[model samples]
Target: MTNKDVYIAKMKMQLDELDGQMSVLEARAKEAKDDARAKYEEEMAKLHEQSKLAQGKLDSMKSATAEAWDATVAEMEKVRDAFVHSFSYFKSQL
Candidate 1:
């Protein structure tokens, strides 16, 4: 496959992994005690937001026009960095 195809595949895989992680977080949040559940729910919300943003970025990357690929890639990189930063912050809080 072409490099773009491979990249897209990788992005899709990462998005799938994030979705699974969010599912686990949601389940954990639902099962926790009152105070801890609140905290877990808050963290899960933040992660869900980040995951949504990442998915948006991936979707944009996948659908970008040929002439716009460079700019789209740059924006996707920024989105990825933001997602990673948010994930780290969320992990630190837990």
Candidate 2:
């Protein structure tokens, strides 16, 4: 595969793994107290929005031209970083 292809594959895998971890967190959130569950749901909603943005970026990347690949990758990384940071903070609170 080309470098771009490899990078896309790696990112897709990472996103999948992150999604799985988020699922586990969702289950844990359900077991929390009412107040805590409310907070967890709010954070989860933000994460889900970020996840959707990242997925949209990935879809764009797949169709990107060679000239646009780098820009698309950069955008994807920013979204990924934000998602990861948010996830980490939420997990710590749990």
Candidate 3:
């Protein structure tokens, strides 16, 4: 397979993994206590938003070449960082 094909495959796999993680997080958030439930929901919402944004970015790169994969990777990294920051802050509060 070509490099672009490989990149697309990898991107789709990453997105699937993120979707699975989001689902698990959502379940955990729903199971949280009354006081902590709000914070958990907020964090889960942030993650869901980031995941949507990341999926959009990945979709936009459908016609991209191997060289353009870098941009997609960078966008995914930003999303990951945001998720980490939000998760960490919420964790610290609880």
Candidate 4:
């Protein structure tokens, strides 16, 4: 398979894993104490926004022309990095 195909497959797996992480965050939030729950809800909102941004980047990558593939991958990587960092930071706070 082509490099782009491999990258897309890898990224799809990571994105799926990120979705699972978000679900775990939601469940933890539900179990949080009152004030902590509010905080978790607030931070989780931002995480969801980041996740949406990542998904958008992923969608763009999926349809990108071969000539534009590298640039799309670069942008996707930035989004993925931000999403991961934010998720880790927020999870640590819990």
Candidate 5:
């Protein structure tokens, strides 16, 4: 497969893994006390927003032409990295 194809596949897999982690985090958040749960939910809301943005970027990147492919990859990586970093920090807090 081409590099773009490989990159797209990898990103999709990573996003799927993140989604799974989010599910686990959501379950943990549900088990928290009311006050803590509120905090977790707030973070989760931010995460969901970021996730949506990342997914939108990914979708667009998939259709990008060769000329735009590199730029699209860079943008997608930025969003994905932010999401991953946020998820890691939130998970550490729990």
Candidate 6:
């Protein structure tokens, strides 16, 4: 379909995958030992915050008009990329 449509679909898919990853990370954090658990919880908390930010961006993107779609996508991607990067690094730790 259109660029806006494609972008929106892609972003939604990415967000879904990111949500699943967050859950996986959450479970892993819960499984850690006492000392490591504290650190994991801190990291997970930061990740949760990032997830919220990304979700907000996604919501904005969904409601954005054609004229504003590009800008919204750019902003959404920034937050999505940060979440992906952080999740990748966090996964490596486990």
The TM-score of candidate 4 is 0.92
* Model 2, position 52: C-alpha lDDT score: 89
Candidate 2: segments with Cα more than 4 A from true spot: none
**Number of the candidate with higher lDDT, 2 or 4:** 2
Candidate 3 per-residue C-alpha lDDT over 3-81 given as tens digits, one digit per residue, 9 for 90 to 100: 6677667877876876786676677778879898987887777777877777777677776566777786677667656
Error of 2 at 4 (Å): 1.2
**Each model's TM-score, in the order given?**
0.76, 0.97, 0.72, 0.92, 0.96, 0.88
**Model 4: runs farther than 4 Å from truth?**
none
Candidate lDDT scores, in order, read 0.76, 0.92, 0.71, 0.90, 0.94, 0.86
Look at candidate 6 and give me any clashing residue pairs: none
lDDT-better candidate, 4 vs 5: 5
CA lDDT for candidate 2: 0.92
Minimum summed lDDT over a 10-residue window in model 2 is located at 50-59
Distance from true position, residue 64, model 1, in Å? 1.4
How do the residues 1-94 of candidate 5 rate in per-residue lDDT, one tens digit apiece? 9898899999999998998899999999999999999999999999999899988998998899999988999999999999999999999989
**9-72: candidate 1 lDDT, tens digit per residue:** 8877876876776676577568778988888887777777877888888888877888998898
The numbered model that scores best in lDDT is 5
RMSD of each: 2.1, 0.7, 3.0, 1.1, 0.7, 1.4
lDDT of 6 by residue, 1-94 (tens): 9777787788888888888888988898899899999988888888889888988888888779979877887888889999989988888887
Q: After superposition, how far is residue 5 of candidate 3 from its true place, in Å?
A: 1.4
**What does the lDDT come to for candidate 5?**
0.94
Q: For candidate 4, lDDT tens digit of each residue in 1-94?
A: 9887889889989988988988998998889899899989999999999988988888888789989988998899999999999999988887
Q: How many residue pairs clash in each candidate?
A: 0, 0, 0, 0, 0, 0
